[model samples]
Target: MSVKGVTPIENTLEINWQGDQKSIYHNIWLRDNCHCSECYYPITKQRLLNSATIDINIKPKSVNVKEGKVEIVWDTDHSSTYDVDWLRIHSYNPRLIPLDKKLKDDDDVLKQKLWQVKDIKDDLPQVDYNKIMQSSDETDNEEAIKEWLLQIHKFGFSLINNVPISPTDTEKLCEKLNYIRPTHYGGFWDFTADLSKNDTAYTNFDISNHTDGTYWSNSPGLQLFHLLYHDGKGGTTSLVDSFKCAEILKAKYPESYEIFCKIPVPAHSAGEPKVCIQPDIPQPIFKLDHQGKLIQVRWNQSDRSTMDYWENPEDVIKFYKAIKNWVEIITSPENELWYQMKPGQCLIFDNWRIFHSRSEFTGQRRLCGAYFERDDFISRLKLLTLGREAVLDSI
Candidate 1:
């Protein structure tokens, strides 16, 4: 294709193309898929797309393709002409392809996001353990605590040791952690003798590999737990990097990955005063992070019984089986890090990215749990550093 002249008249692009009449103008396509902040949200976070108001009807008026360059004119009076070379670089086909399928020019964005969790190393910000340890009893260390929490914000999780062992202390620790309990009970999973003893009030059985609070319309983003009494017996906490698990599944079972991407799993909780029913979250078991890195995995077999109801029952079965196997591979001792929480130690993790569970304990063991909205942490960090909250809510 050859372009004779290229010019931007006002906001419209003027382009001449010398190609078969059947060939759709390429510049027009580029204008429609512009990824610029003006065309789309600056932060292309998956959740942000729901809030975006895009003008999908807008189209380009004309296009011209020359030996080396192409020009595009927009139909809107205020639109701008774009160069063909630039258009080609940013164009993307909107067709929903399976996570395993590679689009024409896009790299596996999901894979790229997934691998980021594995590759994160020293580049992540760190908290000064000494400073936190030296804080006095009288001074308000909220500033210091905010600094420590910011490190956890940068890293998916962080650990603190030597907290005073008391229920009051546990509550205070959660407050310092900026805990924003879910409006519903979705955020807190109480591990108390009262709840555990009452089988009807709480399900005290062993929990399988899964993320928490999937039944909530808006699940808590961060989970915090403080060990009040370990008694030095059992109940070691185990955490698996869900992102790593996702990539392993994607590589080993491409068919299962495709099945999960296509199927919608139902998640709900019933027989309670506050019951929750979520019909289809439209989320991949694995998802890419803000930087286009895959770092989140949402899988809970107990809540996944709805998978069998999918239109493609066989595919759902295959996906369930694949995920079951994948969970086993990822949660194995070799792939996970297990830490026995001494009395008074606390653990906090990103709910969306990490899957945590504990081995059954024989004797009495107690732990206090709390959760904070994702934006709370972000706001705390921004306020600590910028002296004011960014006001940008919702991750």
Candidate 2:
């Protein structure tokens, strides 16, 4: 029974959404999403009624539009009102055109200003710690904190100066935004030049440019490192915008780019000294969405294990060449950003987009840092900053 136009018949309610588009809503569905006091709690914004308890054949005695609201009076003597805008935003009509091409336009909503070292050399998106931090009793400074998060969300990295030079302070800072995502090493981990430690980060060695947690399926998103103590020399923290390097690779060598995007490189944490019992995960150096948009870049030459998934020698040869080409591009001086992190300075970077490393140093260089879940970071960003409307004006 196709609807001719917007009308409330015996059981169905058809809405004339746009010029020639009509969206149909059933009586039951309209009741389920009812914003009435009895149906939904106004304070908690939680639904009070159990969905299963609602009658499947429930009918509306009367339905009419008044002052931009759809008023519905059920046969059970319950009245409900729905704003037109709310219904429009949550409409699910297959024939109705979607707002955007992407299902979740969250990433696009950020309006991320991607860049290389040279792009941000003169004007790094740095903010003071006081802007983000809040007292126990006081509320957060909305605009300042929003700007701080906007910087990180846009640039894939940000610097926070005047952070407290204390253990777990980096982790505490993340609390202002979100919780710390725990890993095999532990949350709020501290690393220093220790001969007894198993990981290279614990030693004064020159670590090549790489993103952490390549072996895991759900890699950590945000990494915050606070240089609590760094009396050492030559231990300059190096960062490379892997996304920028990836674009370069995509343009120069499309074949290698294809291999890098398709081939699943094997990696495991068990191979690294004492970090054992971890599952082997296979992922491409470059991961793309279904629409062929670059989503993430996972690269760590040191952590990558010998992958025998593809027996074809030609495929294997091409995979190695792709990895080599990507590595060369990232390690190139033109892409590297060097910064000698001092005490009380915190570096926050995206683990999915930025490849980070440190140069070899002589003396002590203790740092406390923590990882934040990607989902939580994105969730916070949506609520605090302007949502889809932020990018709507650009359209």
Candidate 3:
């Protein structure tokens, strides 16, 4: 076992096993487990075998060390190799438990952080809705529109009632709101359009419990729907707070929370301009903010790809079952608030924070809607807050 040039560095340990020399750095054991697709399968939820799986019968054909890498040719028939970093980690720690354990623990911490709500009220400033609306007829009204936008930001959404009802007036209202956040997507839906038409843009049919733009890489944050004509039929809209749903999950199934936080489930759209492919981001179905306030829940059963990264298979199944149970609880009659928008009334809502659905209608129900970016709402809120401070100083 006399290996040539066998020299161990001051802080490193060198080992020569059957002509193969491996240098072990002091911190090699704590190296981050590379989150590569080959290393971790997002769908199978299994970690590939580490260096302990190396064949003992194989003898190194050649061993070379350069830079920070140890290159070796294992037996002519092996036909493959290993990286120095990988070898160092594998050799130093035969049991690959810490990386995965740390990931799971970090997930727990993130879940805790997400469930706690951040106090944003102190950071928000007040604005005058009437002043802002009046300015809409005057100057460009950038200042006024910014103030109205702040109200929407503070309330998550707002209802503008008492506006005169007319198809032409509805179009003007949308145009005015457009100044707040230019509608990335805009359309009008009525009874005439086949309610049965299964399209994302216009859905006249009775919708299910779902969020809009789950397929988008960054879904539209806000949605404004104006009721131009309501025949007073059975088309009432229902809303449920997603944060409330998260709270129910945290209280009901703690183990399921642990599993979801560890697993990385694929959520993507199969259409053109592929939306998002986020990795094991370690998010729970329900998360609380820093102040122990419920924040949001990432729920969409239809978009769930696979739950292979979960170390515990049984736990993964339990987590999904818990999600279904939570959905049932939130959508129950008691939890949902139903409101029918009258003609000339507008409803704006945070698409991310609230889940909305409409009941099947009997008569013609016409409505116009537009979407806005989340960041745009934040920007308008900030500007309005600053402007309000300036006005207060002038007083």
Candidate 4:
């Protein structure tokens, strides 16, 4: 977007774009967004000026536009320049962006493509571990890693093949994400069915489909599972797309879905004697944003501590019915995806939208993996999916 001309009217700058489109920017908005060294710190890219201190009626004394840039000299003798692409991306003019497309400041920008059991059967996202490790730059010439991350973003999971079946290579692969999220079990875990931690994950029980870290306020976002060794029989892993299940429940059992969305479920982690973990604020099984878009799905009956949240006995009955329906939808044989993970296969999935479980097994088994902070993982995804400049434009 190149600026063709600018007109100041009633303390607002109206920019006439080269493509016959125009945008309106208030004087106060421009004055508050000065990009000078004193006004904005370049290294941090954070504003140094307090927006509240700027005068609301501030006007620019002069305006200049040249070479896809806009320059303005304000009445306070402050000068600022803006890249036209930034202005186009942040344009608030109704001509450019409709009311329905307007996004809240904190709303998630990534779009999702929900999947089913048969959707990815023949072409499940699988990336070569060697190709991902060959590239040092995560953002450039790394389509393999980007596609792997994109699959997780779109379908909630991706499998990385031939990971060398060792903690060292797994740790190196995770470090490419920048950091590992430490948990009650610790960071960069390597354990077998020795019950090192006091959790169901430490046993060879037939664990039902559930999301991990339901007991914490901010649960782990990305969970990596690498089957290093498992010679025993009858321990196949399964995953269910909880987002898809939620939609099915909403369509089939509207009442139960509403109850699950509105009601809160309490969960606690009391495995460790001195380390009890619980969420300060209880969350619903189906979490939605202000726009009613599903943002999270927290369903873990194993970790649920008590059902004492509601006072109405009828609500309790409805919740029970809801959970029953929810369980059926998630556990249905048609919806579940069973996999016999091989020794060199590594499965990384989104903990927020995917439910994982394992069937009971015999003999010894060893696995190694790590947890990733949601922000850190998404940061890499955004950068890899969209280049630095594109990310800035989207913001």
How much lDDT does each candidate structure score? 0.56, 0.77, 0.52, 0.83
Give the alpha carbon lDDT tens digit for every residue of 1-395 in model 2. 12233587656788875456677788888998888888888766678878897788888888787776888888888898987655655566633434432324544656667677778888988988876775331554466677777888888889999888887666778787678887767877888777444668888889999998888888889898887776657888888888888899989988999998888887777744667533355888888998788889888887888787885668888887887888788888888888888888898988999889989988887878889888888766765665444323222
TM-score, cand. 1? 0.60
Across residues 1-395, which tens digit of lDDT does each residue of candidate 4 receive?
46788899997889887768889989898877777898888777789999999999998888898787888888888889988777777777733642223232332445666777887677877888898888668355777777778788888988989888788998898876558898878899999998888888999999999999889998889999888998899779998999998999999999998998899888999988778899998889888988698888998989998877686778988998998999999988767999888888899999999999999999989989988888888878887766665655555
Off by over 4 Å in 1: 1-147, 150-155, 186-191, 196-204, 271-282, 288-295, 379-395
> Candidate 2: TM-score?
0.78
> After TM-score superposition, what is the CA distance of residue 121 in candidate 2 from its true location, in Å?
0.6
lDDT for model 2, on a 0 to 1 scale? 0.77
How far in Å is the alpha carbon of 48 misplaced in model 2? 7.9
- For model 3 the TM-score comes to 0.53
Better of 3 and 4 by lDDT: 4
Backbone Cα, N, C clashes tallied per candidate: 15, 0, 15, 0
Off by over 4 Å in 3: 1-132, 136-151, 166-197, 200-204, 257-296, 301-312, 386-395
Q: Write the per-residue lDDT of candidate 1 for residues 1-395, one digit (tens) a residue.
A: 33445444443344433342111234434455444455556454222232234344545566555446454445654343344443333323322222222222233211222223334433433344345655443574555676576556544567766677766665666666676585444445556544633222133346555677666645567887877764545677776667666667678877766565556556765545555556456456665555555545667766654444556556756876876678677777655666677766677887877777776666666777788887777566555544431222211
How far does residue 147 in candidate 3 sit from its true spot (Å)? 6.5
* Most TM-score-accurate candidate: 4
The C-alpha RMSD of each candidate to the native structure, in angstroms, is 9.5, 5.2, 15.5, 3.6
RMSD of 1: 9.5
